[model samples]
Target: MKKTMLLCALLMSAFAAHAQESRQDVSISATGTFSPTIHGATGTYTNTDTSLGALVSYRYLLTPRSGLEANYSFTQNTPRYVVPGTSDNNVHLRQQEFSGAYVYTMTFKRYNPFVEGGVGAMFFSPIKDFQTTQLDVKRTTVLGGLFGAGVAYELSPSFDIRAEYRGFLGKTPNLGHEAFTTNRYRVLSMPTLGIAYHF
Candidate 1:
């Protein structure tokens, strides 16, 4: 239809204008994930494995100093559980995070330091294998909060390398089973380094 074509043309025009102004950027990063041991009050505890992962981020600047960002991360690790004298249990899980945040940036020379805070959900899916000891466990999702502080060094008009530390606060994943339940909360630390391309 003519109307549909007109709308599509307008949308493309807007996007082209936005890209010309360098108002958006996309980043891909490698991360090192570290989670501390969590001890529950009811004699339950969890120890999570340190692992390597990846993060993808998109940002749209509302102003020169403020913007909105969306981030997705993927990591797979194992968590070992100890529940009051039961045999040790460990589950191999693929964990994912989906979050959106408000990003504030300050510029000094070519270094842009930024901070962000947001809310999201964490999903843990157990992989059935010899490494996973619990058969009854299933997938679990929990709401959580994430915060980060980092600096991006501008290499050119369209490229930069960034380093950051981000933390996620959430309840320990129990996978819908008592033996693995900690009924406690913990923080997962992610340190990242990567490059970004502006558009």
Candidate 2:
């Protein structure tokens, strides 16, 4: 019994020491985002917009090649009308998303390539008119999903630069409280650049 207990204690101590030596457990990143046109319909109007945005993410590595990540991003653009006489009149359309993903990474020397998939919620808000006091004409929340791929180049043991392309899928947003004449879907393509710090 005494020998067995000693053996287990020794094994536990070795594991703790190894964990300390391999401490790349947490990472944080800041990103700049660009999104191309998103198309959808609400009532009789079609919505299309391009946007520039920002994102921040936190990741916890479960292993060398696998991690869980949470991210938040915000984007704003002006929706172009498909109708002949309709005009945006300079109003801005805005979206904010919060998501969680599972990431898989492949590591080689100083470069790591990764793929991720996730689901979350998005908040949409639109401005009625740029010249008026109505900042948010309507606000709504909807389900959203994402898939992405990226490459990270390590600058040091603790920092890296990353670039990624992501696609966001969701139902078309209705800018007002009226009933929808059509239920449409939209996919927004986003490219991002960021720097990550690992600890």
Model 2, position 35, has a per-residue lDDT of: 37
Cα deviation at 94, candidate 1, in Å, is 0.2
Task: Give the candidate number with the greatest lDDT.
Answer: 1
Off by over 4 Å in 2: 1-47, 83-90, 128-136, 177-181
Steric clash count of candidate 2:
0
lDDT of 2 at 166: 79
lDDT of 2 by residue, 43-161 (tens): 24555455577877888778778889888888776654343344343346667889899999998989999999999888877756653233434777879899999999988766789
TM-score each candidate.
0.89, 0.73
Record all residue pairs in model 2 with backbone atoms less than 3 Å apart, i.e. clashing. Answer: none
Best by the TM-score measure: 1
Candidate 1's clash total is 0
Candidate 2 has its poorest 10 consecutive residues by lDDT at 81-90
Q: Model 1 Cα RMSD, Å? A: 7.4
